[model samples]
Target: MFTGLIDKLKGKRTAAVKTPEIMGLRLGASFELDPLAIRLILDELTIESCSPTQIIRAAGLVELDGTWVYRFYTDDDAWLQVVAEGGQTDEHVVDVKLFHFYDTLDVAGQQAWDRLLQREIGAASYSLRERTYGRVWTSAGDYHNPVHMAEKTYDGDGEHSLTDQFTMLFERPLSDQRTESLFLSAEEKQEQAGYLSRSLVISTGITLTPSQLTIHG
Candidate 1:
């Protein structure tokens, strides 16, 4: 199945697959598109074939710099995008991003997502916002990783006190402009808020192993 997921979708999954009832961050566990193949990630996994079997047309979207981004069409609710550099839709991809935005999910579906990520990446390494911006990072422990972990709660509202958000940046890389913002722009720092990043980053790769973790539904 997908990476190791036995999950399946009912409709023809487009670049834009139907949004699940699950949250975006939680979907990370359920998603597994091969880094070498620049095509439709999985929408459904047949018993016989588990890899991506669909090809899609590029949307010709560009972002960050001149980097070309290709976004697929999912249902109106959930959105997944593939952004690559130099307009090269071929496999020479340096940056890859998959996003899951779904309708509020049932508990079973929701837990499915959480358990998968908790098993893969240790946990969301950091958090932010007066009202919980909930950024999940794909990092083993570092927050700069492309993924931002979602928060359990969103009461980031400075009800206790007005607060400022601190963001860490990692110079320049694949998709976004992270590091330049804070280093070139920070004019002040707070003295009291407690912020110690697990500063942890975890990385795991897939292979042709019999012990891969599989999620079945």
Candidate 2:
């Protein structure tokens, strides 16, 4: 899939597979393309590939086991297609499967399979934090570090003063929707951001919504 410059430069391709249960399919060698490119391609595909009878509802990338995958859904939020990287051959055919139910496994077997999948997929969540401290004043006008305040003060007035308190909130909401890959890498993030920005500019005459954002991603 990555062999050709035109194909690689084009980045990814998504198609709707005609099947009973599955409504869509996406194909790509990497989620390494600019996000704007992904969004633009998706927008085009949404209109071009969908039929009057079947509406393209949602589409985006997914990451499983460190590899990026592509996904598409229908208006009913039904699984349409799930394609993984490294599965395409020289013919450019994707190793995608129409949505199908796996054979029901017994409780013990299901548990084992779940554990194995988790090991490969890593944790389902991530968090990060940082801390720093320096000379600062309290609401009562007392300095946090007297020695530092003294060293930096002149005529009992400090070079730096903390007159107000500030706080920041962080939260990660649980998503009923699925996540594509681990957050796109730093480079990929920049690319995707740029792409979306450009798309918004071009689509200025159109009303954008959360659904548009989903398609953009």
TM-score against truth, every candidate: 0.24, 0.21
For residues 1-217, could you state the per-residue lDDT of candidate 1 as single tens digits? 6733433354433354322121121122233345332222122211112333222211223244645443332222222344456645445345433322211222234455444334422323222111112222345453232323221111112112221212222221112222111110111123256632222221111111112222221
How much lDDT does each candidate structure score?
A: 0.27, 0.25
Give one digit per residue, the lDDT tens place, for model 2 in 69-90.
3434344322233333454222
Candidate 1, after superposition: displacement of residue 150 in Å? 25
| Shift in Å, residue 104, candidate 2 | 17
TM-score quality measure for candidate 1: 0.24
Total backbone collisions for each predicted model? 26, 7
Question: Stretches of candidate 2 above 4 Å error?
Answer: 1-53, 64-67, 87-93, 100-217
